[model samples]
Target: MKPKASPKTDQSTVRQRIVDMAARLFHQQGYNQTGINQLIEEAGVAKASLYQHFKTKDDVLQAYLAQVSQDWFRQVERAIAPLDTPKEKVLALFDLLKSFLESVDFRGCNFQNALVELPPAELNTRQLIRGHKTKMSQVITDLLADADPDLAAQISLLFEGALITSQLYHSVEPVNAARRIVERLL
Candidate 1:
């Protein structure tokens, strides 16, 4: 006889689907605005199932943050892997951001946006944001190990400022502006 299928047969992928939906909704709609009911309805999971996967909305936020950190860094690393110079890697960062600025999903840095939703005393959320920024800084550090410290700092500042300006103006001009700054630094 074949094994019986349960109503919860979708359990295997339910959590991942929930996390993915939450990430998308949180990024596109803003964390403060997305609600638990919507997360379940969109994920196609029952309320019990959502609760089973995540104790609270905050849990899902953490999962989304983790996913963003991992996905963003992995992409940046892969995008620069074929390049041969620190300058190339540094410039490539803007190229990557340019694509993001053009994408329909553009909403600035997720970590930075979350700061508006989460209180400063929210340790886990704050740490995740800090950790993401630190990793980004390390990427620049590794890429510019032999470059001038001032130049590295300037590039980092431009990269960050570009994200905000691009989001605010809904234009790639900020990225272009940052690229120009980077050229002068180099």
Candidate 2:
């Protein structure tokens, strides 16, 4: 006879589905506006199932932040991997960012948008955003160490400026401009 599936296995699968759906919704619709009911409906999970995964809506938001953080970092690592030199690796990040900017579905950077939209009460989400940004900056600093140690700070600043400008201008030029600056710095 086939072994029976445990409730824990079903519960874990439902929880992951919820988190994945929540991440998609939060990215598309902002956190403050998305409701738990809508999330369950989208995830195709019951309220009890959601609660089995997350105690509160805040817990789901925390999970979303953590998920996005990991996803973004993995993308960054993959984007930077093709190039050999540290400078190339660092500049490749801007290339990765440009691809995002040019994406038709791009609304903006979910992390920065979350920082502005989520309430001060959402400390876990805020911390996750902060941690991701710090790690990104550290990666830049590390890559720039061999080339122009002094340029690491500028690179991070330029990266952030480009991110904001790309969203603000709704164009890919800011990424190009940042790339040009990075090229000059190298």
The numbered model that scores best in lDDT is: 1
Relative to the true structure, how large is the alpha-carbon lDDT of every model?
0.87, 0.85
lDDT of 2 by residue, 1-186 (tens): 989889888888898999999888887888878999999999999898899779998789788788877888899989888789987898789988989867735467878877888777877878888888889899999887766666888899899889888888888898899899899878
* Reference-based lDDT, residue 81, model 2: 80
On a 0 to 1 TM-score scale, where does candidate 1 land against the true structure?
Answer: 0.91
The candidate 1 region of ten consecutive residues with least summed lDDT is 4-13
The per-prediction tally of clashing pairs is 0, 0
lDDT of 2 at 46: 88
CA-only RMSD, every prediction: 2.5, 2.0
Each model's TM-score, in the order given? 0.91, 0.90
| C-alpha lDDT of residue 8 in model 2 | 88
